[model samples]
Target: MLNIKYDIVGSFLRPSQIKTARAQYANGEISLAELRAVEDEAISDLVEKEAAHGLKFVTDGEFRRRWWHLDWLKEFDGFTTEHLDIERGGVINHIELGYITGKIFYDPDRSHPEIEAYDFLHKEAGKYPGITAKKCISGPNMILVDNYLQLGIKEVPYYGSDVEGLIEDIAIAYQNAIKDLYAHGCRYLQIDDTSWTYMIDEKFLQKVASLGYKKEEVLDWFQRVSTKALEGRPEDMVIATHFCKGNFKGNPLFSGFYDTVAPIISRIPYDGFFVEYDDERSGSFEPWAVLKGSDATFVAGLISTKNPELESLEDLKRRYAEAKAVVGDNIALSPQCGFASVEEGNCIDEETQWKKIDLLVSCKDFI
Candidate 1:
């Protein structure tokens, strides 16, 4: 029999106080230091709640940024903030591309944002010493997507000035970032990635085909990039890849099935894969066999945060069982995504968010 372990993928569940502080920061009423104080208090409360819920792997809930991962990377170099194009979605980003600290950090020129968000995760984890602390970061490839296309930077870097160099730097930077978190005693890492979804998009797919690449070739690209980022890391490190379909406000950017890119998704292995199977928009779970790794674990997203309706335990269990039918029993449970991928959060409130996690905890037998 497979030894099934249960855990939940972590994300920021925004609190009311943090929202007020954001307005204060906007109106110039609170200095950055003051803002930090408010953020600290919110994180303290969030950590307490997770403890109350008995979650073994706890996160600060990504409270640091206004957007999902982009907001968090304001600390990196070669980036700057700018007026966002209304059509292209993004969070608060480093203004230009000059501040990139490397594949993982910024230059020691004191250019990095002096925010304590990531470390705050350490503080809360230490407080609960009983639960494992998880740190979430945008997957390496996703950073490349958000940086170049969303911001409309057409120029290439001189180091290589092409896709190859770009991907290498992303992997390198992630390693550095992971090292920093590990030094602070973090044992779990989840890379939030939406790149695969983009690859399967109609427009982007046409763009790749325009370059004379075959469908199989594009799929290989996803596997290679994802694998490159996972390369040469500590075997004991609990690294997970989140297969997301974009979360902005309560809106989603794309959706499809794992079969579209099954070859690579299944081959480029990781300890666990966090996937969305909450609705048919994600198609059937048939491709999960492709995602199956030897001794590999899976976090089945049976609870959805997009809608406010709290899924019934019976209904959630049915969904979990459906995934098990294909992968044959190596499955876990979590919401399709965070209660709040951005500041506004997924169309739900704190009450509903807790109810969702509570459901996961309640459905332990299925998980």
Candidate 2:
């Protein structure tokens, strides 16, 4: 079980400096090195603030990239982003999609930008004692779910109709990536995934059927890919998964409960699970009863990052009690999701964001 009782879902709201620097880089007003200097300063300050706030871990705030998942996904071989001419209405229409042009593989000899980012975070975090620099990456299932299941990019000559083969290759690529990260001194890794929640969404279920795939089969594939990715993971490395309904611009893309995915959640080989429960859309805590006696830590995301209004202390304790009744003593607390899953961020202001973080830290006293 993870010794820490309070945690964060990783990404913090991007500061104005980063936003301006990125835009300058895009418009050719600033060089890439100049933009990186701004990001470096921002991240260094972020690590100091996180440590001062009493957080056990710190991230680079994902400041280097635009979209959380796409930035990391595009780094892998055979995966590239493309603009689609066809417009699918709803949340899918807002974002860029990825395409698999060849077999997915991770060449260890090549330099990875994420590794370089992690190296900087690890160094800054080392300045403060007892602080671990945690790295957050998109889960393996994200690529398949977003590209194939949602966007219907089903035709890939390499895997051609062999869905299981595709999943295996993705798993292998992720396994190699995890090994590489461990080598880079990343002991705490969080897989930020929105796909698990999609499995329970009604609209997403309809889309699954429309794609000629059964809901159960897709769940199994998600589980398989996730499990295979962690094969032979180091014992000292702590791997956790954060599951939230899409978090884009203070809005959720899908709505559902954890009831349907509880069994699959129990089956995944993660050391912990950070589940969204900040509002009515998450449903009841009864589903977590499936994990009552397990050693894995169940992080109840009882605070809301989307809303600025602070959660009442009494109400937070009450809800924590409700979760404790079902999931036993192994539990932690965090905001439902990151302050910014994308570069746009949630609706809350930075002052309010830190206040929420203060509340998160305070809640740990009772736990």
What is the RMSD of candidate 1?
3.9
Q: Determine which window of 10 residues in candidate 1 has minimal summed lDDT.
A: 93-102
> What local distance difference test score does each model get?
0.68, 0.89
lDDT string for model 1 (1-367, tens) is 1123555656656778888998999999999899888888888888888888878778888776776666655656544454443544555532222223233344333433323465677778777757777777776665555554444344544433365665666566566666666665667878787778777677766665665555665455556667876666765677777877877776777766767765577666667778877778888788777644456677788778788887888887787787887776667777788777778777777788888778778888656
Model 1 TM-score relative to the real fold: 0.86
Q: TM-score of each candidate?
A: 0.86, 0.96
Question: Could you give candidate 2's per-residue lDDT for residues 81-151 as a string of tens digits?
Answer: 87655444444545677877778888768999888999999999999989999999999888888668867
Model 1: per-residue Cα lDDT at residue 48: 85
